[model samples]
Target: MIELVACDMAGTTIDEHGDVYVALARCVEEIGVETTPEAVQEWMGADKVEAITALIQAGGGAASPGIVAAAFTRFKELLVEFYAANPPVALDGVEEAFRTLRGQGVKVALTTGFSRDVAEHLLASLGWSVAAPGVEAGDPGKVLDAVVCSDEVPAGRPAPHMIHRAMERTGVQDVRAVIAAGDTVNDLAAANNAGVVAVGVLTGKLDREALAAHPHHHILDGVKDIPALLSFPN
Candidate 1:
């Protein structure tokens, strides 16, 4: 039985309209380093600072710590402004899926490449509250059991720390009983690295072909399909 479900935020669970990527692209461009959409897509589920540094290096600019910091700051500002004008909303049936999974005794967690502040901001905008590990046992009324941010872990997606942290937080000991779902290659990679079932969702920028190139056990249309795919009790 699946005891835990670790899902990604932006493209996987929330409909942010790809504004995060736009902000990332603009931040890199403002630093006088031209970046392609493909280049930006490569770091979709990575740490923002790391992504900015890589983008700078890929574009032949010096990825000095100071430069990376400035770019990251700008990226945050851009995202905040964009979200203020165009608030993010939960993807169709995601909350229902969360409730369904939690109702069936499965823990639902949101693991993101976003820093804690950005992650919290996004959650607040959507009026979602997740219990913090080591803080609370998780409110039964909350949509999520826990939320693991990239910055809280040693590394972001493609590294598996966040997923591991989620498992640790949720007190799930068996990797086989955990399912990690997301919309990017990094998400699949992270899940694979963590030795859990990797599920790819089509709600993000990547299409079926792109996600198929990665190591994933299942690729669904969206998060809402997860409970059905898992054969959870209805």
Candidate 2:
């Protein structure tokens, strides 16, 4: 039986695009690097620095402390620009889905590629913060058993570090009893690397065929289907 759940934010739990790539492009542009949507799409589920690094490497460029700092400055600038004009929206049924999982006695945890500050802000505003928002009286306590930030990991998704960190925090050793959910190919890859079941939701950038083709265990339309996922015998 599954006792722990490790879910990913951005695309898996919410829309992946929401200012991420926009910020990326802006940062790359500021650094005089030309980036493409396809390239941005490749780094969708890793830490911000890793994405920037990938951008640098793909173009046969090198990054030093100075370049890294400059890119981050521009990235933050773009993020502020995005939020100043347009806040992001969580996917439909995301809140309810988290609530339902908490009610089912599942120990929930979160893994995300965004920085701790950005992830916390997004979660706080969405009420899907690290755990559920309202956890008093009729409310549930923070829904998550733990949280693993990409920055906290050595490499980030597609590396299995984040998932392993969450699993370690939750003390879940049996991969079969764990369901790792996300919305990107890298997320799926991370889950697979950890030897846990990969559950892909379509709300992220990658669609069903693409996600499924990558060896994910299950594919769903959105986070709302999580309850159904828990019902299966393991």
Candidate 3:
């Protein structure tokens, strides 16, 4: 039985409509690194600072600490402002899936590659936030068990820290009893690295072919199928 479900934000739970990539391209361009939405999609689950550094380096530019910091700060400012003006919407079936999982005694945690401030802005915009672990009573239909951000972990996706932090915070003792689902390869990689069931959903930027290239236990049409996956005997 899965005790917890670790989900990714943006493409996974929240529908950004390519805003993150747009902001990413604009931010890196300020530092002389020209990139495209397709390029930014490759770093979907990575920390923004690391992604910016890599993009700059790929463009034959030095990723100076100062430059990275400045670009990251600019990206955050742009993203927050963009979201404020055009708030993101939750993907179809997300709220229903979360409620279903909680009804079955599964903790639902939302993890993101974005920094804490950005994550908070997203949560606030959606009128959702991380509930304290072990809270006995709350609107299980609406509250999340935890929210893990890249800034809170030593590293982001493909490193397992975010998943580990979510598990730690939600009191999920066994990796076998966890399910990590997202719409990117990095999300699948991170779940594999963390030794949990890696589920790929086709609700985001990545296509079936791209997600199939990664290690995963199952690939679903969307996260709405997750609750069904949990209902099976393990």
lDDT of 3 by residue, 1-234 (tens): 789899999888889776888888788998787776667888887888888988888777788999999999999988987887888988888877887777678998998889988988888878776656565325643568999989898888789989989889888889999999999888999999999999999998888888998889999988888977767321
Tens digits of per-residue lDDT for model 1, 106-218: 88899998999999999988888875544332454478888999889888879989999999989999999999999999999999999999999999999999999978999
> How much does each candidate deviate from the true structure in C-alpha RMSD?
2.3, 3.1, 2.3
Over the stretch 65-113, how does candidate 2's per-residue lDDT look in tens digits?
A: 6887689777867776676577666678766666676666666788988
- lDDT (Cα atoms) of all candidates against the true structure: 0.91, 0.76, 0.85
> Quick one: best TM-score, which candidate?
1
Model 2 weakest lDDT span, ten residues long: 132-141
TM-score, one value per model: 0.95, 0.89, 0.94
lDDT at 74 for candidate 1?
Answer: 95
Q: Would you list the rank order by lDDT, best first?
A: 1, 3, 2
Query: Could you tell me which 10 consecutive residues in candidate 1 have the lowest summed lDDT?
Result: 132-141
Residue 43 error for model 1, in Å? 0.5
* Backbone clash tally (model 3): 0
Residue pairs in collision within model 1: none
Candidate 1: residue 204 lDDT (0-100) = 98
Candidate 3 has a TM-score of 0.94
